[model samples]
Target: MHFKVSNNGTAAVLEPYISMGGHAALLKNDRSVFVHLHPIGTISMASQEKFQENYTQGVLDREDICFFGFADDSTGNYFNSNTSPNGEVNFPAIKLTTPGNYSIWVQVKSAGEVITQKFDFNVIL
Candidate 1:
């Protein structure tokens, strides 16, 4: 699989040759700064399904389902603004907070097998 990345100061935009299954990025110096990105968005599909299930079953109050501390937005649509239809994954710009080394791990599924590729980059302030 091949990937092309474009760093826009605060975030990195990735265009993969093929559709991606899952992907993540981490600050090499500070592990606390990590983000998992998907083709859909920040919220995982499993989480969305679970939230839907709970909402459908009336197990949780509609007003109580908060996403990333935002209430009344259980669908996670607010955080999914970077979704693309061209097999591109756009990570949040906040992930590149400080100038240092970073690693982005991209995963793709092919023929029922999962393959992971790690790409390294440096952020200079």
Candidate 2:
């Protein structure tokens, strides 16, 4: 699902993984940035309240569920964050000490019981 905050600094953009990643410059010159992570693409999540009753009576694999982050600069000096209490979804944050560009990413894995997938809304300041 996509997120809209009326007139907030955060903006969403669909960046598809290209054959070569293409020529992109994830940079900005601002401060007090915000990143709203929404569910992008996922491995698929159905109903799984009952583990044994579900698939082969075993837990799912969710260790691959990891998020990736990158700064706008080559120096790599950006902060990172994760989801909230339940951990279903999240909005990772990065406080910019220097007004420059930064890149953020997230990967929610499909576990045996619970899992989630979110997007990255960049507010580069």
Candidate 3:
């Protein structure tokens, strides 16, 4: 897989040359921080699925009502589209609060199998 990284102000923009999939993650080396990323955004698939189920069952109103546990006001509009374009997965900026080493594990699915790539870098204060 080919990946290109560029800086967009404070965020590191990632352009991975592979079909976008779910279950990508970034982690601080000391295990102080971890973020799960999706092709759309940080919102999890299970959460989105639950929101859809609730909305369909009439258990929740479609406007301005937030459910508990990771549900936000934009939950209804979430998962409406994929943020990444063709042949590239765009991740939000990488923000490390402290100066340290970090590793990013990006997973993509191809031919019904999962491929994982590891990238390591350091953050200098």
Candidate 4:
């Protein structure tokens, strides 16, 4: 999932651009589970950079999960340096402890405007 910053109602028209540094994400599940994520994902920018460096150096001990590869290319495709961008915002994978409906709110400032989007989903075994 890759989010392309754009103005209201129009997508192809990419917003001039801004840093994702101050973006925020809030997720709630029936008031039971809640989490706040930074623009970099679930961790701070420093932490994300550390992991990226480690991966680049091949210092990770486990091979099950890799959090390294997010790059924007000339084709406006952001991928794992190989995969293609699909226009869906990529959020950190989440684990729900219980089964219920959840709502996610993502807030970001793009082109001097604060944009917020709400998404709802269901969790089932």
Candidate 5:
């Protein structure tokens, strides 16, 4: 839901789910994510279902986490990931592999219906 940037470091929120349905997307109008970046240094990303006590604004309710890459080798699908059943993507950390165009998405639904949020970005590795 937020990206923290500083001389200290760059931190992003990422979910482990293979789809774009989660709490981060549920809280705001912006559904998708796109980034054009070549990491200047080490980066850390996470999907936080429950924010730590020090976090003033906290997470709502959830308990699943996932992180995925490139829906397919094709460009049309738009690489993305999100949270699962409990609105929580269950992973806490990820190690950098490679870099290129990247996409991030979050989704949420209610009353048997569904909604989707997505975004795309580039990693200039």
Candidate 6:
């Protein structure tokens, strides 16, 4: 799942998502599965940065992309949104481990205010 956070209905202010490290949390109603996601993927910022650094340093080549858990073609250009009139922050995909009801809290800070939007979904196999 992905979220497109915009400002004043048109401009997508995604700095918070980046500055906050793309913090998105999920909780199953039965409390069976939980995961924290970043803009790049379901990985910690430290590790993500490390992998990014390695990629830039040439220590890791394109062929070695699979070595990093957070590297994915789908998200390779996740942060490049300059072409879009509204900036956008794309969240990583969320896969439910078990079939059940789940609640997602998509929190983002815009103009110094932290906004939280709650969404519920039922997963069925």
The TM-scores, one per candidate, come to 0.46, 0.21, 0.54, 0.49, 0.26, 0.61
Mark the regions of model 6 whose C-alpha exceeds 4 Å error after superposition: 6-8, 17-21, 44-87
**CA lDDT, every prediction?**
0.49, 0.28, 0.53, 0.48, 0.31, 0.58
Off by over 4 Å in 1: 1-20, 44-51, 54-95
Cα lDDT tens digits, model 6, 19-86, are 44346678999888887765546666698789779989988654433211223422233334212223
- Residue-by-residue lDDT tens digits, candidate 1, 1-125: 22433334322332222333245555465675677665444777798789779879988654543322223333433235312222333333444667787787876433344456688888898
lDDT of 2 by residue, 14-111 (tens): 22122111112223335344343323222223433343254355455322333222212111111122221122232233355554454443333222
* Residue 18 of model 1, lDDT score: 34
Q: In candidate 2, what residue range of length 10 has the lowest lDDT sum?
A: 71-80
Model 2 Cα displacement at 80 (Å)? Answer: 28
Query: What's the lDDT for candidate 1?
Result: 0.49
Ranked candidates (TM-score, high to low): 6, 3, 4, 1, 5, 2
Best by lDDT: 6
- Please identify model 3 stretches exceeding 4 Å from their true place: 1-20, 44-46, 54-86
RMSD of each: 9.5, 16.2, 8.9, 7.0, 17.5, 5.6
lDDT of residue 54 for candidate 3: 91
Taking all chains together, the TM-score of candidate 4 against the true structure is 0.49
Local accuracy of candidate 4 as per-residue lDDT tens digits, 7-120: 455542222113332334445554867777543356666986787799789896323332221333322332223221222234456677777788877654444455677778
Shift in Å, residue 22, candidate 4: 6.0
Q: Residue 18 deviation, candidate 5, in Å? A: 12
Better candidate number, 3 or 6, judged by lDDT = 6
What would the C-alpha RMSD of candidate 4 be, to one decimal place? 7.0
- Which is the better candidate, 4 or 6, if ranked by TM-score? 6
